[model samples]
Each structure stands twice: as structure tokens, then as C-alpha cells.
Target: MNALLQQLQDKQLIWLANQTEAPYEHCQSTGFPALDQLLGGGWPQHNVVELQSHGACAELQLISKALNHSGSELLQVWINPPAHLCAEYLLQQKRPLHQLIQLNTHRAADALWAAELCLKSGCCIDVLLWQNSLQLTQLKRLQLAAAQGQSQLYLFRPLQTGQQLLPWTLSLQLMPASTGLQIRILKRKGGWQQQDLLLPWAELYPQFIKPELQQRHSSYPPLSRVS
Candidate 1:
């Protein structure tokens, strides 16, 4: 009887595996080997990703390489960025500034409206929105918009604000490490990641500031003071 139950479980597991979609089919390589491996190849396209971090800039550094590789035809849109995007830094990394569209809004509602428009228009392949708090219903709306336009949507929020469940294809918690960034995969489609992955900062941001200086300046002030 025990042997019979074990056989049934084995067949069930195989069936589940076959039913699941392979990660590489839908993911875009994040440009980091360790991260790519952890994410089952890369970030999922046509989905909403939630990035939580103490410092808003940390998320930017994590995705800079992917953004740079977006090509000329598709524009990278930034809605209410936390800090001024340093043109010199982008130049250093060889990311084309002309390919970026930045929009500033005084209210979160406006930012959400603009992000939805950008995602639904099919004009941009990547949209980054820095909004600290969003309702679950609002996130669902954005997720649907991303799916409709086949665009990758990244939403940045403070670590403290991500305690609630959200409708995200991939959700990650980024913390600063001595050598690089420590990524904790909070939620994903297939399975939960038990271990945190360390991605060297130099690989993505060769000109990253020293660990000591980065720590000294990395603090989340009030969102009102961000601009």
C-alpha cells in the first residue's frame, strides 16, 4: 500500500511540472548571473514586479543593466522617480539618455494614471513607477494594463509598505550588502525562494559608491522630500 501511494505521488509531481510553463519562455535576463538563476532565468515580461527597498536608488541600480539593453525603438518611462537620474552616470554606463521619458507628478493618483496610460499605449516596453503605497485593487488594475500592452511594469515601494499581499508576478526585497546587493525573493509564480542571493554591485554598477558612503547616505526620508 505504501509503495502504491509513493507511485501516485511521483506521477502527480510529474504532472504538475508538465503543466507549468518554463521560466525562460517568459523571462528577460536581469543581466546578473546569480539573479538570473534565482529568478528562473530573469524577470517576467508582460507582468508587474514589486521591488521593496529602504533606499529607492537600490532598485534602480538593480535594473539599470536591463534598462540599458531596452534598445532604441522602445522607450524607458520613469514616473515620479525618487531622485534625479544622473545624466553623467547614465553616460558612463553608455545608456542612451534620449531613449528615456521622465514624468513628474505631484500626486500619487496622477502617477498611477500616467503609468497606466504608458503601459496601455504600447509605446514603451518598460515602465518604472516609484509609488510608496498602493491599494491591492489599484495594483490589480496596473497588472491588467501591463498584460494588455505586453509591457514590463516595475513598481517601487518602501520595505515597510510591502507587508500586505499584492498582485505581482515577482516581488523582491533588496538590501545593501558589503560587496553587492542581497536580494530576498518574497514572492514568485512557481515556488518560494528559501535563500537570499548576493549579486556583486560592480557587475552592474561599476562606478558604484563605496559601501561605507552608500550606507551613510541610504535613508528613506518622507516621500514629500524625495523630489
Candidate 2:
């Protein structure tokens, strides 16, 4: 044990104590192996993942996958999902409704506050903030709160502009592919490789399919949104 500690100290002297054998918490997966491969094993428990997309549906699918993957296990998921933002679709994903903390805040500032409060608590491991109407101050405050909590954050913002400015551990911009969607890792940390990967729609939701089923769906859903 001493030797192991000594080696870890030598390799990660600055973070040795913090990283020392603390039960190896599994990261929350986005339910796509290809995308999970892009973001190391999965999205780290204590980091921010930026989902900069042009539309709302893409971000919704990604966030739902993460929530379903974690699902009453190692971490709980809290989402500031306003009423106008398609809550029925989220429930239709078939994840546990009870485990989800659904907040109904219309104002962007209120939503940001709820998100920050959820993050600050160590109880919640993952949070998804749907920010289609957030201002500059709201974004900065959310960023600061996320940083302070040291918890995993998924910020979904609709940015139809040229590009996005990323300030998180991982930045993913997903585009429409011929059949499915193309996910690109615009920013990353650690040993993550592969800037771009093709993630099929079928791959994102494996639970909906029967485990013993051999056939695969032939048609892809109509391309309604891209980010």
C-alpha cells in the first residue's frame, strides 16, 4: 500500500490525495459508445460538458441519454426543464421520472439560479441546463457556480451562429449526418482522441430495442434539428 501510494505521489504529486483510490466512481455515459469513446470513458463526474447546438432536439437527446445511463445509480440528474421546452418528450425517453428533479422556471435568471443551487449540492452528480434564452450575466454566473461545486454540468445552448466559444472540460458540436448525426469533439482534456465520429441514432437509445433482437431500424428520424 505504501509503495502504491508512493508511485501515485510520484506520478500525480499535485492531485494524489484527491485521486487516491476513492471507489472509482464510474462516469455517466451518453449511451453512445462512439461518443463515450470521444469523451474518455464517459463524461467525468466533476466537470462541465458543453453541448453547443443549433437546435433544441439534439441537446435533448444527448442529455436524456446521459440521464438514462446514470438512472438512479451512482448519480442523480436534475434538469431545469421549463414547460414550453418539451417535457413530455423527455418523459417519453423512458427514464425514471421520480429520479429526475424537474424545475419549472420561466425566467432565464431563475433557471440559472436553480441550476447553480443544484450543482452546489454534492448530492447531485449530473445537471442539464436548457438555456435557449440566457443572457451574458446568466451564463457567467452559471459557469462560476459549476466551477465551485466541482460537479458535472451539461450546458445546452442554441447557438446557430458561425461557431461557439467553449469553456468546459469537453465541448461537443453535433451535426446532421447522412443517416444519423456527426459528433465532433471541439475541446477535450486528458488522453481523449478522435476529433470527429459518426454516431447513429439507433446507438444513442439502446434500451428501447429488445436485447435479443437481431434486426436494426432501416429509416432514420427526420432531421429536425442540428447543433
Candidate 3:
């Protein structure tokens, strides 16, 4: 009888090992090779990623490539975006405008509510939310909801908020640079990266800057030359 019980336990362990998926297998590429290396392949699915930056533009640039590469069937929802998203810009980047949805609200509470609902609904595979501040408790709630919906949740907050310990699958800080954006990984599931990566802003969106701005900033060194 003891031998029979041991055999059953061994079989169960083997079955569990076969059913579990490797962590890297669940990641989706961020479209930037350097960024992918830092993230251990790509962004983890069914997790909440927090991006803090001075302006929403930097965060948008970071994820623009991923959005453009995403499938047409996957909906990308934006909640309380900082500024008006130009349709022409998205189209030029090869992002399907039809798959993009935006929900605007002035109140923070309303914005949070809408974002949580969208994450829990499972109607969208990717959800982007921009808000002023959120308590750790509130963030945890959203994190659980995101896990349940199996959605990729991105929360954008102002850099002024500083750093705080929170339950996030990944967290990053975006600093504007003359060449592009400097990304610092604050927290990640498996490990932490101390070094910062400079991703050329122009690589993600060629037409983002106006002709006048480009001419004025042309003297600045390019991203590759930085550091």
C-alpha cells in the first residue's frame, strides 16, 4: 500500500511539471531588442506594468512599437489619456486605429473605475491607463483584475510621484533625453536591472516631432552616441 501511494505521488509531480509553462514562454516581445534583453525576452502576460514619466509622450513612445506589432483582433484600450491621440500618427506607424479605443474622464475616481472595468471585462487584450495617483491598495485590486482577465495592463503615472513599493509585475522609469527616452527598470518579477537603456525616440515614430522642432534640435547628439 505504501509503495502504491508513493507511485501515485510521483505521477502527480510529473503531471504538474508537464502542465506548467516556463516564464519566458509567457512573455511577448517589446519590439526593441535591447529592451527585450532587459525584460528577459519580453513583457510578461497577465501582469500589470507601471511606467512613470514626466510626460505621457515618453511612455507612449516606449509601447508604440508593441502596439503597432500587435494583432488586429486584439483591442487596445486607453483610459484618460494625457493628450489627444492623433489618428494620422497611429496610421503612419502601422497601428490599426479600428482596434484602438479611448475612454476619457476628468475625475480620477471615474478614470480608475473605467480602467478596472476594462481590465476585468476581458474585451481588450491591452489596456493603457493614465492617472495622477493611486494608493497601493487600489493598485493591488487592479493587478488582481488584470490577472483574472489575462490582459496586459499598463499604468502611466507622473514622475513626481517618486518610488514606492507596490505589487507590480514590472515597473519602469522614463526620463526624457535629447536622443530619446532613458528607461530604468525599477522592478521586475524575476530580477532587477540597475543599468538604464536609451531607446531612440525616432525609431518608434519618425513623424512624431514637427519639422520646426527637429530643425531646432538637430544639433543634439543622436541616441546611439549618448553614453
Per-candidate local distance difference test: 0.79, 0.63, 0.77
Q: Candidate 1 — what's its lDDT?
A: 0.79
Top TM-score prediction, candidate number:
1
Better of 2 and 3 by lDDT: 3
Minimum summed lDDT over a 10-residue window in model 2 is located at 16-25
- The residue-by-residue lDDT of candidate 3 on 1-227, one tens digit each, is 98987898888743443443344347778878989887887787777888988774457767776666565777889998877989997787787788899998878988888778878887778899988788888888888788888777888888755556776678888887877778888877656445898877776556566544665655566889778
Residue 168 of model 2 has an lDDT of: 49
Sort every candidate by lDDT, greatest first.
Answer: 1, 3, 2
Model 3 pairs whose backbones collide: none
The alpha-carbon RMSD values of the candidates against the true structure, listed in the order shown, are 7.4, 8.8, 7.9
Worst lDDT 10-window in candidate 3: 13-22
lDDT of 2 by residue, 81-132 (tens): 5445445665686655566666677676777777878777766656877677
Candidate 2, overall lDDT?
0.63
Clashes of 3: 0
Q: How displaced is residue 214 in candidate 3, in Å?
A: 9.8
